[model samples]
Target chain A: MNNRNVILVIGAFVVHLLLQVLVFKDIVMFNVAFCFIYVGFLLLLPFEMNNMALVVIGFIAGITVDIFYDSLGIHASATVFMMFIRGQWVKLITPRGGYEVGAAPTIKAMGFQWFSGYVLPLLFLHQFVLFFVEASGFGLFFFTISKVLSSTIFTFIVLVLGQYLFYTKKASA
Target chain B: MRRLLLFLLRHRAFLLFLFLEIICGWLIVQNNSYQSATFFNSSNSIAANILSVSNDVTSYFSLRTENKDLAQEIARLQAKLDEKPKEVILVDSTTNIAEIDTLEESRYEFQTAEVINNSTRRFNNYLTIDKGSVDGVLPNMGVVGGGGVVGKIKYTSNHYSVVTSLLHADFYISSKVKDKINLCSTKWDHLDPSYASLLFVPKHINLQVGDTVVTSGFNSIYPEDVPIGVVSTVQIPEEATFFNAKIKLVNDFSRLSYVHIVQNLMRNEKDSLESLIQPENE
Candidate 1:
């Protein structure tokens, strides 16, 4: 809707791309870097961005990562669904339009506490659906659960780090 | 109606999220196997390239270890050669075998080849070797490395063939105990490639930890008596008929370079007769 929003979207997308190509791969010690790329779109959606658009972005983000990880559609689908819950996350955390003008609700924009609300629930949902779909549903119940919980923690930590690095507390508007 | 409209407006994101989740769920269901995506191609291709590069750098580093293993294998083979040679000449199995017969010796022809590409991490995994049909690497031949059975050949071109790693859920190898006292199927537990489980061995059998497990080679993908792994842990869940024996693999699939692809000289004759006996392949 505005210049700042476009920049955020474009900038986050670029960061997501670089993360996939250069980082978050093969270094299994952190394991959570597996889905950290999607956090770019997860953290940077514009304040006035439509929920449907965000979902689409999530889907796109998931699919893009899936393409490289060779995990197939597991990511695309998980991410789109993640985008779906983000609005309620914003509302629950900051209420109506709590974000400053032209500033996102990332860690830099809304501080750590504000971003945590967005991070935790969405991270849980994204990972749960992601792992569930990846396991083809309900087969190894404990495995799917462990994967979700571990991956959620990993995704959250990386997303927070990305937000700290990327988000800016500015009002171009 | 007005309440519904207000609810929809207030909770649009939740509603949409649910919808997208449903779509993802449906797509997952459509894929019968929880096939991790084709992202493997990109990562694997790059990784294969990186491995080739790293193989260049690390080959120099690992030459000592590789040479050490090779030296050990040579010593072992020399020791085996010192044993009294048993008389094992194959007669016509169908007609003359009824008269007088001792234990059939496992015939094996070894072909040396370099490991071109291999992967242990992915769901549906494949390994390629430099030697192929041109080098007498026919389909269904057994491949071994680091004193452990790696896998069987799936397909072959002139110079290369795809061998499915035993680490793959889709890959199953017929194997059992060395003494033929216990028979079980070997499988990767999907936890680690370095460890696999010997399924369907009943709890009734005496399976101690550190017992050697080898290829019984009944159906003959591999020669009888090739090493697989040692029993790491034995589990007897009360609800199951089979004892779950964990096997600590002897081969390090990650750092593989050279291997011995074994050719069964009598495979075709055995297979043709086998097809006539059973309607379905065991």
Candidate 2:
């Protein structure tokens, strides 16, 4: 990515982290659905970004958020795992012409159908690992599963809305 | 060696992921254990400061309820003060002077703290208070709200402390049914924030709905007879040895703005004496 894009991504990272801890932290619906909007930062990173860089950024973001949540390592492990798998997920869904270099996987960049396919499963996996690990095991199997599903849908809705409001359709570098 | 090096290079990313996951697993395990005093929690200065600012803004919305609770607390204290003289007169006639002197020396000291951040929807919940080590607040101290017991101090920094909320899955407090000597444990069932399960009550004990539960003070963390909750439901399954009872917690955890950290002044002496007897039993 270029210097300007790097700066922009960093800015988004701080914004997402701050909004997650300060605003979205308290907004749980019926004690099941949680809005973890910070995951959107990882999901929307440029496709061509280095896997190592992505994993490191995920670790930093997760740990910072973990401090605020008082859930040390749970968020970090989930985010890093998702970031590690992101490269493969991107490769698995390559379009016929392939993605443009340095293209972000935003809804504006990729159409709604492709974007949902790309983001939904990844968000599901992230929430799955997060809630189960926080609960320590499948001891509360059904309850934890419900939490994961609801949180995934809640986070996905917020992420899409955030992208629609803020992200502009920029030509790939 | 060359082939091994190639394999290592090919899977370096996976190796990093494994290594980091191990670290996270270690942190989760370490943090789950009692009183580890880690610096990565919300009690850290930067996170606590941000939460404090956010709380300052949002707390204004709950000011009316907070004032009402405080006024009620004041009225309760006034009522107790009015009865103190008659109790002292009866005690003077019935008890020895030495016993009265010992009773007058209060064992628990309370320090007021503002809750800067709190969470209730998680499997494990915590609250960060604006008081810390500098304020004489330490880990393992009991925190109580005006209404009832809140939680215990989990960690303390210089100016902030994290309390393990009573709603936490791992949290358990020694409690007993009001006016009955039978002791039971109060544990969060992880289903609802307002209710917690009362465990270990014998089947023969007559447990009724709406029975008040209070801290037994068996562990010396909380003061004896402090209001915990009222038993809301009691069920005895067939062939079970214990009754399955639930209590509606007295403290409204979501609206918690302030708490008092109870420091047991004689805790060190009691703990040291107890430690001396443990080895003999072993």
Candidate 3:
């Protein structure tokens, strides 16, 4: 990454972290749905970034939120697990034309339909792993699953809002 | 050797993922152990400082409700003062000087604190108070709100302390039915913050809806007769020896903003006296 891009990514991570800790940490909908906007940091990374680097970044991002949530390693485990599976996810969702090397898989880079298809599954996977790991027992099975479902929808809405507000579609020309 | 090197290089990402996952898993296990989890909780200085700043902004919204709670507390205290005794109990005045001096030396001292961070939705909820060891708050100190028992202090940093709230899983308070000899333990089921189950009440004891529950004073941490909750439901399982009473907690944890930490001044003395029966305990 160029110095400017690196600075922008770090700044984005900091903003996401601050939003997660200072704002979203207290926002619970019906005591189930939770907004985890920090996951956007990992999702918005450049497509061609190294897989190893992605996992490390995800771990760091997760731990930053974990520190504030008082959830020690739960978020780290889920985020890293999601990052580990991200490579396979990318291969599964590859377009027939394939991705351009420098492009990010954002709603702006790809069309809205493509972006929704790409992000939804990954978001659900992260939410599923996160809430289950947090619940930590089979006794909370139904409660945890409901939490995962609601949180996935809640996080996806926030992600969509963020993408539309900040991300711009550049001309292929 | 070249093939093996290439294979290792190719799978390095997966290997790193595995390594990080293991480390995080270890941390999760350590955190659940409860004894050494203090450093990873919100009571840690960095997290506490940040939350305190955020609380400063959000606490403004709750000012009206907090004022109401404070006013109610003052009224309760005023009523107690208004009910002064008509006559002195002691007829003899000779030894009353020494007795009065000892009575004035209360065993429990109260320290006021603001709850900068609190969560009720979590299964194991905790409240972070903006006072810590430096402010004479210590681990295991009993914390109470205007209505009733809040929790026990779990960890402390320089300027903050985490209370393992009454709504937490595995939290049990020794309690008794008001004006009754029945002693039982109360615990939250994690399903609801408003209710906790009173356990080990003998089946024959009659319990009414709205019967008061209070701290039993069996444990030195909390003083006797601190209101905990009111009986809301009574259940007796078939062939079971005990009645389970669900209590509606008086303190609404979702709106908790301020609390008082109870410091037992006579804790050392009480502990030393109790330890004589089990000399191995230090």
Candidate 4:
């Protein structure tokens, strides 16, 4: 990524973190579905970003949210785990002709089908680890599973809608 | 050695990931302990300021209900004041006797604070109040809303304090049924925000629905007889030794805007005296 792109990414990071803590923190539906829109920012990092940098960024983002949530390390651990797996997941599901260097994995850059395939599993894994870790064990097996599934769907829908609303479509390579 | 260095270099990202996770694990464990003051929480000055600003914007929407709740609380307190017996003073000029103090000294002092941020949907929830060390608010002080028990102060900074809400899964308060000698513990079931379960009530106690639960005063943290909740459900399995009961919490956590922190003046004395027995037992 260019210096300009790096600056823009940093700006987006701040925006996402603030919005998550301030606006989306209070937005819960049915007492189960939670909107973790910050995850969208992590998922949309430039495709050429190094794994090490991605993991570090994820830790920073998650820890920031954890502070506001008073949840300590649950979000950080979950986000770090997801970021570590993201590189391999992206390569495994690379579309025909592969991705353009420095391109972001957004719905606009990658079509809806490929984006869903790419983002859904990663989002699920993130939420799964987060809720389970917060719960501390399998004691609330069904309840935690329901929370994970509903939150994944809730976060996924908001993420897609947010991308469409705020993110401008980049021209095809 | 070169081959080992190359292997370590090749897996350096994974190693870093593991290291970060270990740090996170340590943080999680460290924060789980009660009354361990730490900085990364919402009670930190910057986070609390941001939350208070956001609350300033959104609290206007709830002004009507807030005013109504405050009015009701005032009316309740007024009724309690009127119920007290009137004091009579006798003049004895011939003896030149000094009058004894008629007013009873209260052990608990309360300070009002605004709730800047709160959450109920999370399994372990916390609240950030606008009061802190500057206001004499400290960790372990009991917090109560107009309706009933809110939480216990967990951490405090200069201008803000975080409360471990009653809705938190790990939080438990010593409590008992009103007008009964049997003591039980109230703890959140992590299912609903409005309800918490009462544990350790013996099966033969004959608990009924709608019984009021109040603080037991067994701990120095809270004053005795603070209303916690009203029993909503009561059940006992055939083989079980204790009754399984749930109480509908009096405080509506989602709409909580203001709380009073209960400071027990004699808490240090009580705690110190209790600590004296520990060494002999060991």
User: Each prediction's DockQ?
Assistant: 0.32, 0.86, 0.74, 0.87
Candidate 3 has a DockQ of 0.74
User: What TM-score does candidate 4 reach?
Assistant: 0.95
Question: Which stretches of candidate 4 lie above 4 Å from their native place?
Answer: A170-173, B86-104
User: Could you give candidate 1's per-residue lDDT for residues A1-173 as a string of tens digits?
Assistant: 76755775677687766555344543343322244555656656667777777877787677566544434467778777667667656666675655666556666656677667667887888778776665554866885577678767776777766555644434232
Cα RMSD, each candidate: 7.0, 1.7, 2.9, 2.6
**Whose TM-score is greatest here?**
2
* Model 4 / residue B124 / CA error / Å: 0.4
TM-score on 0 to 1 scale for chain A of candidate 2: 0.96
Q: Assess candidate 1 and give its lDDT.
A: 0.67
Cand. 1 TM to true fold: 0.66
lDDT of 2 by residue, B82-150 (tens): 986665454555555423455434989888999999998999999999999999988999999967999
| Residue-level lDDT for B140 in candidate 2 | 91
lDDT of 4 by residue, B171-244 (tens): 88999898864478999999999999999989778689989999998897788788999999899878999888
CAPRI tier for the interface of model 1: acceptable
Give the per-residue lDDT of model 2 (tens digit) for A1-173. 67998898899899999999999999999789999999998888898887788888888999999999999999999999999989789889999999887788987778899999999999999999999999998999999999999999999999888878878655243
Which one wins by TM-score: 1 or 4? Answer: 4
Runs of candidate 1 exceeding 4 Å displacement: A1-23, A29-37, A91-96, A136-144, A165-173, B1-144, B151-165, B168-171, B191-193, B202-206, B218-224, B235-241, B253-282
Clashes of 2: 0
Alpha-carbon deviation at B260 in model 1, angstroms: 7.3
* Candidate 3 accuracy as TM-score: 0.91
- Tell me how many clashing residue pairs each candidate has: 6, 0, 0, 0
lDDT of 1 by residue, B1-282 (tens): 999999998887677777766765665444324332322323334434543454465468678888988998888889887762433334455664533243344456788877765656544445767676678777678888778788877656566565667776666667776654547888886667788988778777788888888887786678777788989998888898888779988888877778889877777888898789686655
